[model samples]
Target: MVEIRTERLLLRPASMDDVPAFHNILSDAAAMQFWSTPPHQDEAETRDWVAAMMAISPGGGEDFVIEQDGRVIGKLGLFQFPEIGFILHRDAWGRGYAREALTPVLDRAFSVHGLACVEADVDPRNAASLRLLHGAGFEETGRASRTWNIGGVWSDSVYLTLRNGQRDVG
Candidate 1:
């Protein structure tokens, strides 16, 4: 029941009610082009994914649906501890919603959850995601080659991190 409000968005925990919209977003090839897996083929796949996400206990993980004007437009969350990821409907891109949605989530991770730092792994070729991380004050921490076999393609990864106080981690 952790909910956060930004100037233009509401971030709330995902629920079964969000499955349809979640499926729509996840099934978009363009929107999911950089995802670890290909676009979900159908709603059943999304249903299973959302079911698992909704079943996570508090403190184990956090997944929030991004809402604009009461419509679900995307999702953002932590996976295990500090690893973070997000996805937005392609139509919502270039509108600064990702940054707007991520800032407060990072705040909660640092101030509310008391985490020392938050990290993200992005495919190096995903320029928009790399730019988003950098624009949000996360610094590049490392890089790796063929780190992930995403959708059968060997993908390099760029690791970025933001510590409490946005301090550089040595």
Candidate 2:
């Protein structure tokens, strides 16, 4: 079901229908460079992820499909801790879809949900993600060594957070 709309986008629950478009983003090398696992080449994996989201809302996340011009470019939304996470097709980067997808979600997280704070954890190496989050009002609170598991290996992680009243780090 579609949940919200921006001037040029649609934010909505992802469907099995989105698997192919979603797969394109997932399979892009540049898009998944910093991802814990390699992107999925098959639609089955994408469907499985979508199924999980349908099963239980993705563990405190309100996952949304970021659609533009009737095409799915990526998935974007709020996860647990009210933090924002999004992955856009490499082709769609730099066009402000990230902000289009995140702004309303952040508003809902702070204003509607009354979340105390929201944050994002980025791999230290993901410069694009860092810039995107910071541009969307996230700040790096600190960095932790050996903090997360990705591709079965522990890696250092960056931690960031946001508070109420629309206050943000960047």
Candidate 3:
């Protein structure tokens, strides 16, 4: 099992046990506000999503659950090679958990996986996510208007990239 332990978090592969907590996070309106899809309606939706995630070969595609005090609190992972994404239960936000969870994952991406750079795309209006990425040493690469039609809303995207060893402050 691939697990990365930080001072306050455990980043581990997703499991069937996480579906309920995952569903809770995915279905929370405020938490899903910046996500590509709207809040999931039910557990079945989250179940299928979790099933797919679990099917991926371990460590072949990065998808980790953020656990704190033995409870699933969030997730951070590469959705596609080099493009990272993450989500936390609204209750878990603003406590530096994202940074704590992401820093080591970035290390693994660059050191273990040998990726030269990691990229991210965020809705330009999401100030919190922007700050998190920037605080993690990601530099803005570009921005495009109407780049994503998320939940029927045309959203602009801010692109950022972090080259290996570019910034170590996370």
Candidate 4:
């Protein structure tokens, strides 16, 4: 469980203590609009999710809880190797925190993990997230329609990747 610090944020492993704050973000409808699933219905669900995060096998993945000003703001890191995922509380949006937090995680993914590339799957309608990944050096690789069916609504996906060398791997 590695802990990371930025100028204004802290990225650390998820814990039971993070459940309340994390649930705040997970339960927000607007914040979860593009998430793989709908906003969590209750704190119990969040607890299960955090418990699962804590149980990931060593070297299997990382799930860093993003904290700012000593408060949990979101989560970032690869729960699955080579494929990155992140989400922030709606209140933390548009403040550069995601980009700031992403820098070192990408560094760790390539340098520490020695991965050839990192990938992301974003909902096409999530313009802000797409811009964030692009600014972090990810490039669009492909797109698919109706890739996710969440809470009865279907959403498409845009696949992007950032190679270790910061160049196109194609």
lDDT of 3 by residue, 1-170 (tens): 48888999999988888999999999999998888888999999999988877776645568789999998999998756688999999899999999898888888788888988999999988999999999989999999999878678888899999999797654
lDDT of 4 by residue, 22-101 (tens): 89999999999999999999999999999988897768887789999899999989888888899999989999998888
Q: What is the TM-score of each candidate against the true structure?
A: 0.93, 0.87, 0.94, 0.96
Each prediction's RMSD over C-alphas, in Å, is 2.6, 2.5, 1.4, 2.5
Q: Candidate 1 regions off by >4 Å?
A: 167-170
Backbone clashes in each candidate structure, one number apiece? 0, 0, 0, 0
Alpha carbon RMSD to native, model 1: 2.6
lDDT of 2 at 25: 84
Clashing pairs in 1: none
Per-candidate Cα lDDT values, in order, are: 0.86, 0.76, 0.88, 0.90
Could you say which candidate leads in TM-score? 4
Q: Give me candidate 2's TM-score against the actual structure.
A: 0.87
Worst 10 residues of 2 by lDDT: 52-61
Query: Clash number for model 3?
Result: 0
- What order do you get sorting by TM-score, best first? 4, 3, 1, 2
